[model samples]
Target: MDNAPLVIDVAGINKRFGDKHVVKDLALQVREGEIFGFLGPNGSGKTTSIRMLCGLLTPDSGRGTCLGLDVLTESAAIKRQVGYMTQRFSLWDDLTIAENLDFVARMFGMKDRSTVVDKALDDLGLSGRRKQLAGTLSGGWKQRLSLAACLLHHPKLLLLDEPTAGVDPKARRDFWEEIHHLSAAGITVLVSTHYMDEAERCHRLAYIAYGTLMASGTAVEVVTGQHLHTWEITGTGLQGMGEALRALPGVDLVASFGATLHVSGKDRDALEATLKSRLRDTPLKMTAVPPSLEDAFIYLMQGSQDQFQG
Candidate 1:
């Protein structure tokens, strides 16, 4: 072991698929035992970059190490030490949960497959559903099973691509709880997600768009750096009001939360001045509010160009 605090330290990574440049000059350092997130819009190269980090896929150009192993030369070594879960369910749905776990253990060729499978099931709280057909399980249960399957090989790093997508709110919370527990146990995690709430749960976050890096920092730092202002508008016709604000200059994001409208823009003076002018003459009421993570993300993305060509 290198005794280094970082599990992934890479620089100037790039990837291309024929005419398409999927990732561009990306560099990142992920600390051991921290929940670091890679957040971006769809087709933003998050997946490609993550694959390069864990040695799952080769980068056309890059120099780095994962778990003190060369990302390019020691790819097979790194692959054995990482747990990867994809955006879609890839487990055997026709088999029981216990059978699925046992299969994964067998694939890894563990010396004690039964012990590992039993421990995995018990650790993930899947003992109750061990005999259930995976195809009949709900999204949450399926997520748990997927996680258990990944952990069967005793990986040091966990790479999750939107693991909580389509899961219910309560299940998402439970999933996060398990993630935190794993982090506490000295496992490094690199996750990709779009949910602001989930991003907040991460120790640090990196934002990417159009195959380029944007802002990366703690939640508060990133939010503050965006320099966005918000206005909370509450009244009837809020749905139409959102549409009206969309075309207005200086408005980066106009979203509704139940009965209220959140309008955000990077330009503080222009945003306040513009919304003041818009609401001054109309009957609509507006109140200046603090900018949030979602507001900052929207502002950052608004500045991105569609360079992905997808």
Candidate 2:
């Protein structure tokens, strides 16, 4: 535990409800100042794992520490040192932007709430709309406000669940930019997102499904480590092309990449053989391509929900 290369260190973690096993033998090591993306389908224990890391929820089995504090025994202490921004907007809708920040600062018992609120508003570029009501703000502004409120307490770790669900692309990029800034400032952030572009921006990632840890690494490493091979076939009539590719042996994922269809599978030789064999009758040009992260993700989740074999 002392030598684990992570700010949040846990091993063989397990949890369950009355009937359903929500988490099983979960393990993770998230480094300090790293943006670790927790990728998974809904109800797949992503939120439960984040809770275990920060000590908000107790695991039925296994052990770990967060910020050097005992995850089970020092949960209250860990909670005080973490900032959690849930998927839903938790702030008061009628409060002004400045009021929300001020309230949050006061919640942390800061000596100078006004000063902290002012700094947070200015830092998040919300000073211009500091007086605007939270209910009247756009999704981007609401996202900014949530971030500002979380930062008001100045916690070391930020746990964000689907932080960019509805914001525009520019706003999402801006949010990610701010996350990187926080990482540079030595603040560790664990974010769960559905967007692939956002996943690529993380320092490293862990994919979970059906209460199991599927994969974890940098984007390139995760994709390459899957040993998946892809083929980009360019031609018309792509609507039915996916079916053809899926029917071909060894092909697991057939997704469109703009005007081309990216066909991928775990077995390289078999996949390539299928692509070369199937395209002989069509004008589609077949070329081997590298598997993208999304392709690997699709492959990883193929049979995950089939049944509880473990």
Candidate 3:
């Protein structure tokens, strides 16, 4: 990954909207053909940082290049070679799948419009529904169409903002498969998503909170960096146990996952001792488990001060 050329290299980028500082001295580097996932809580400047990286918004103070084009000076050129898929379905709901692709192709002034449209439809499995109106399509199909439209320009970099927000599980899986396919084709993808499963699928991840970057690295690296210890307990009557566990010494977080609870803390030995003493008389099954990405993220968020909170 280090040997690959950087598709996005920016530093000290900051942005604000009146009194709210949305992004703060952010620095990021994305390699060519990398699937970089961005994770954060709401109003954390994930969207704003994406725009700055792609030249959609100018930074208050920063310097860098995106695809070797000056982000501040050559935004027009950068925009031409980038495909941005917004969070919302921005395609014309009234237009057919094929018509929508054609319209996007026309906007980019692409040549051989028919061939491009046909290939896009086929690539996204929309050919069978070429004549179907986008509004009539399900969330999954609409997502596929949005991706197809973004690719019409043959962009070198793709900036996707919550591309699978409301998509079903099966559709989300299918969409991730397509993203991997694109990365294999040498297209760099920077996507923001709230789903932990989706975040894990990325080659690397960055977690931002309150306009500040808190953690970044491969999924394993991020988890290990936090040095968190966890214990998984599952048994009957575990519903109200989470609140009781949180107040115990050495317990930092208690998160429920279905019928199981993951109790985690930063101090390993202390946490183990505390859990052992507390559950000595109970019949519940307890096992020491590795902290999950979700656990690490929640820990990071809890430690961060929300800059927007009054």
Candidate 4:
């Protein structure tokens, strides 16, 4: 990672709308040719932070650089070098696939509009559906077209906001494959997502909540950083077990995954003692397990004070 260039470097960025502080002194760095995932609950300032980083929105107070340009004063230059794919399908629905690409190229004032459009179509597998209407396309096709349009200018950095939110599992997998392909070609990607599986796919992750960053590291690092002890139990009478476990002295979290119940806490000895004493003669099968990404996020959320609720 040290050998790669820095695509985005920003610090001390803050934004507020009315009296609500959306992003709070956020700092981040994205290396070239890396897929960095940004994650948080809804209204946690993920979108606001992404916009500020990519130069789409200015922060209330901060200074930084994006793609080597000043994020504040050089936003126009930074905008020209970055390809932003918004959460919504922001393309023209009335236009055909090829026409949409042509329009995007024209908007960017590209001299080789046809050549760029053709290349984008082939790269995103839209060549065969060149005449298909954007509005009539499926969610997956629309997503591909949006990506294609973003690449029309051949930007070095990509800011994708929940690019696969409504896409099917198969389509999401295909989209990620294309993203990896782009990354291999030296394009830096910053994507925000809610799916844990998608978050795990990134090289590194930053989790935020209530306008503040909670954790930042690899998946394993984040999970281990929580210093949580988890035990999974599979049994027949586990309907109300989650609530009961939450009320116990040592348990900090209790989540049910189908037939298994995951009980976790920060205190190893107390948790173990409580489990051993409570389930000594029960028919449940309990075994110690490593804390998962979801477990760590939930733990973090539980401790976080919601900045908007008050």
lDDT of 3: 0.91
Kindly indicate the candidate among 2 and 4 with the higher lDDT: 4
Ten-residue segment with the worst summed lDDT in candidate 4? 301-310
TM-score-wise, the better of 1 and 3 is 3
lDDT of 4 by residue, 52-96 (tens): 877889989888889999988898898888889999998988989
Q: lDDT of each prediction vs. the true structure? A: 0.87, 0.86, 0.91, 0.89
- TM-score of each predicted structure versus truth: 0.91, 0.94, 0.95, 0.96
Poorly placed runs, candidate 2 (over 4 Å): 1-5, 307-310
Name every residue pair that clashes in candidate 1: none
What residue runs in model 3 are displaced by over 4 Å at the alpha carbon? 305-310
Task: After superposing candidate 4 on the true structure, give the runs of residues whose Cα lies further than 4 Å from its correct spot.
Answer: 305-310
Sort by TM-score, top down from the best: 4, 3, 2, 1
TM-score of 1: 0.91
lDDT of 2 by residue, 1-310 (tens): 2233577888899999889999999988888889999998888998888878777789999888888888878988888889888788888999998888888887778888888888887787888988888889888888988988887788999999899998999999999999999999989999999999999999899999999998998899889888887888897766788876777788878888789888888788888788888888888888877788898887777758655553
Model 1, position 34, has a per-residue lDDT of 88
Best model number under TM-score: 4
Worst 10 residues of 3 by lDDT: 301-310
Error of 4 at 276 (Å): 1.5
**Could you tell me which residue pairs clash in candidate 4?**
none
- Number of colliding residue pairs in model 3: 0
User: How do these models rank on lDDT, best leading?
Assistant: 3, 4, 1, 2
